[model samples]
Target chain A: MAMDEAGGAPGAAKKFLYVNRKAPYGTIYALESLEVVLIGAAFEQDVQLAFLDDGVYQIVKNQSTDAIGAKNFSPTYKALGDYEVTKLYVEAEALEERGLTADDLMEITFEDEDDDWAEKPSINIVSRADMAKIMSEQDVILSF
Target chain B: MATLHTVNKSPFERSSFISALNHTVPGDKVLMIEDGVISARKGNTFADLVSSALSDCSVYVLAPDLAARGIAEGDLVEGVQTIDYGGFVDLVAECDRTQSWL
Candidate 1:
């Protein structure tokens, strides 16, 4: 595989890791961070998203923004596949700490174009140590 | 290469400001935005830390964030430069990487 240089020619896709540590709502970080990810998809970069700490709550099922008067954007995660962003790493420790399980998260998937449009799960449950290693290997780390 | 350190929380509300300051190296640039702009104001408790950091690194405050909070240019601490959103983009481009202290 050819490696892409930073801000270089086309096809030069740099690895972009977006770290989310904040929960959705109460603050604009989570929503704004998603906006950046969506916009960055245009660059065709190798994108990876990590959800840890309070950020794990973002993918929880049945989030109702009706009472809070906020637009429910949790569904956006399901749309990430269309943008070619399918890597969503959820920290196992974070989920356990919050008393959540993989089953509690929303079903987010992407169509594998190369695999004959097969539907694939986007979420990858990983240990904290594994996530840390992944973070160390990224070309760029954008945290929120 | 210098890192662009961004802090979005207020020092009065969180210790993110102090943590960001402690982690920053001599050549790094600290850009205060959102509620973090509160720490850039003059005569505040964190004024000393901001002033001290200025001697070794560049300190900046987002103009729009300051204006949004009614913090005038004159209210900024000494040696702290104020930059607009365009400047923020430029800073990100100029630095090796960005570290946001949430």
Candidate 2:
């Protein structure tokens, strides 16, 4: 669905969008989807992550699951950049509705090897309309 | 004649919250946890619905989830109550049956 406008090149890297909506630790979706992304990173596809609704909590800083007795995998998110999955789209309305700001989230960065190996933030906060447009442009959408 | 219903999804995102509310008998309890706590926040689009549900069943929001979502006690719908995991366990023991609105 993403590369259709690009003449459907058979060997071209397909754009894969991971849509995250549920809150982390509340269900298996968030962690499961993260695992999928890490596993699929081997394919070298163009991957973009979209976090909206309660999914924004997935990246929120200082999450302690000790009381809940669940594994805290939030740290794994920071490692995503190492896999070359650098783009992250977070919905602004979702953060505002939840009384959160980008400052509340963990810092994730990737190095721009092409540009003198400069480190850059990976999270890109977007409006709902912008998020919709980004989703429409993806070749594949994976909902979590 | 009482059942404790647990709703873990946001009412705005999933119909399960409303469906559980609709299926509740009088004297039932509806406890909001995880993303479901968002519906209990004051001035939300579903605030009126939650206020109405309080008349039919006791509505409670999990305290931890509220804190996680940055919802303070003062920000809850007028009639909503907040509870912690211990209270959650108490509700389960007090009720004859437990239903999960997934």
Candidate 3:
């Protein structure tokens, strides 16, 4: 297909979305994917980052990563704003079922997790259907 | 709108990959990486289902996985692309969204 002047599909802006569902540090794949997304953002692309399933662990609060000799990098997720990368989506049910709430999570505001995903918020919860909808609208996506 | 689905495990081992494939639209690409490459072998259900669902969408297997498994490239079914890390990156760049089925 044809990319428009904005580097998106014909005639409009493009959205680059990344999905992460794996636990933290289980493998380097998720981390590598995150780095790629960050690089993509550097190119001045619209980026949205989402976490689901086990991937929720990457943003959990009070992680004892020091025991594993890994730096507490979960905190860096909040720093994504420094790059002007504000789109952050999380699966609401994933956190609720896992006994986690925004208060229990690292200090962050989440969008509502609805399947419609109509309102595009900087940070919010998204239902699976909405996630799929957002994915369909994007010009590029990276999943880990 | 290209939807790239990444499957990282064998088919029988996990229905999540199959579920993901079932939900995929025509013209969407599927890349089998890590142990997921094993499903590309002929006679596997995943190999058959993918071919039937998408004739145009590209299917690929990671080169390292095939090399480590000692499976010759020529042994795989027709139309499956074998790519390295860079080609994989290209897929990431080209698609609109990617989902990992593990």
Candidate 4:
């Protein structure tokens, strides 16, 4: 693996898809997985975050971790844009099955560098089939 | 070009370890971490399953996790190696990709 001057991967960026299929709070997987994403952002890989199955609840708006005595990291999703980790794919079927829609999710966006810092929605509502195709195309898939 | 499969759950508690083992191919590597280190202990009930998989793939257990769980180095399965976090990072970089069986 070649490293650039900043000690980052120098070759072609690998496509990394983080598959989140588990619900948050109930387990540490979701939080720890997010930590990996944050750390991996420095690697300059082509990163895509996918929320499927019960994972859809992770981004639900108005999450109050107060009752659970856990530090709420929901706001971290909003800051992903600063790390250039903006692709957030939500599975359509997952939401429908859980009686949720895109409306229930927290609005996540990134500033478009090419568009004069115009804000663009980060969440891409995709069908399960399309998400599967995306998964197949990824060079690296990190599931949690 | 093989995948580094990470199993973080204990075999006695969950099926993540077995699922990871089942999905691993010949050249793939399995790294047992956290509670997954329990499966790597010598003389365990799952020793046969792990030993069988060792014939096809390499198995590793996180040293710190093993220590935390009071599993001595000598107690690890015959072919299983103990690696530090740096070794874990190297394994991830060496493999084509990684799959966290959480």
Per-prediction DockQ scores? 0.17, 0.02, 0.35, 0.24
CAPRI quality level assigned to candidate 3 from its DockQ score: acceptable
**Cα lDDT of model 4 by residue, B1-102, tens digit:** 577889998999977687566556677899999999999998999998989989979999999999999999999889999999999999989986787877
**Model 1: fnat (fraction of native contacts):** 0.30
In terms of docking quality, how is candidate 4 classified? Answer: acceptable
Best model number under DockQ = 3
**CAPRI tier of model 1:** incorrect
**List of clashing residue pairs for candidate 4:** none
| lDDT by residue for model 2 (B26-69), tens | 67899999999999999999899899989878999999999999
Ranking by DockQ: 3, 4, 1, 2
Note the clash tally of each candidate: 0, 1, 9, 0
State which candidate, 3 or 4, has the greater lDDT. Answer: 4
Q: What is candidate 3's lDDT per residue for A63-136, written digit by digit as tens?
A: 88767886667766766766667777877766776887766667653333463533333557776656655666
Chain B, candidate 1: TM-score: 0.98
- Please state the CAPRI-style docking class of candidate 2: incorrect
Could you tell me the interface RMSD of model 3? 3.2
Structural similarity to truth (TM-score) of each candidate: 0.62, 0.60, 0.61, 0.59
lDDT of each: 0.88, 0.85, 0.71, 0.86
What is the Å distance of residue A54 in model 1 from its true position?
0.4
Task: Residues A1-144, candidate 2: write the lDDT tens digits.
Answer: 445543277667887888787798879989999999999999998999988878899999999999999999999999999999999999898899889999999999999888998999999999876775565465566766
| Superposed model 1: Cα runs more than 4 Å off | A1-11, B1-98
Minimal lDDT window, size 10, model 4 chain A: A1-10
Question: What interface RMSD does candidate 4 have?
Answer: 5.3
* Model 1 agreement with the true structure over A43-62: per-residue lDDT tens digits: 89899998977889989999
